[model samples]
Target: MDEKNHIITSPVMGTFYRSSAPGKAALVEEGQAITPSDIVCMIESMKIFTELRCEHPGIVKRFLVENEDPVMKNQALIEIEIH
Candidate 1:
């Protein structure tokens, strides 16, 4: 694995989606700037939508799952460059 293997870990248990709506682009892409208050992705569970934001400023190196993939609690949703 390369340094791009950095991660955007999920803060809650649910499903991961690349975009807010179908056929739309992802919230964050490779080399995209990530901020502590940025909404990088959304995790929906129990009919509620939980937007997952970054805890620090960095770059989004990778995303761990495909759109609409079922994820577990505390799973890695993306790989981010912390530095």
Candidate 2:
């Protein structure tokens, strides 16, 4: 939670997915460099999946929630070290 780090949060109440689908490689990994338009993860609610994009340029520090974990609106999801 450093000032230079950006915390990404869940946009809605749903289940979080690290990849586009089961058995696929994750969209991002820890220490990966990401752009504002990068799809970091996906959130599924009501059987609909929504891709969550990065809003700042940074290196992904870690994921706060595990795959398929239920998340609430505005809940912390990922921590990124601003680059």
RMSD of every prediction: 2.6, 0.9
**C-alpha local distance difference test of each model:** 0.80, 0.93
Candidate 1 lDDT by residue in tens digits, 1-83: 56544566666678888788778888888789878888888888887888887777888877779889899887877887776
* TM-score per candidate: 0.81, 0.94
* lDDT (C-alpha) at residue 12 in model 1: 69
Best by TM-score: 2
Q: Which ten residues in a row have the lowest lDDT in candidate 2?
A: 1-10
* TM-score computed on alpha carbons, candidate 2: 0.94
**Candidate 2 lDDT, tens digit per residue, 2-74?**
6898888988899999999999999999999999999999999999999988788999999999998999999
Query: What residue pairs clash in candidate 2, if any at all?
Result: none
Off by over 4 Å in 1: 1-6
lDDT of 1 at 26: 82
77, model 2: CA deviation in Å? 0.4
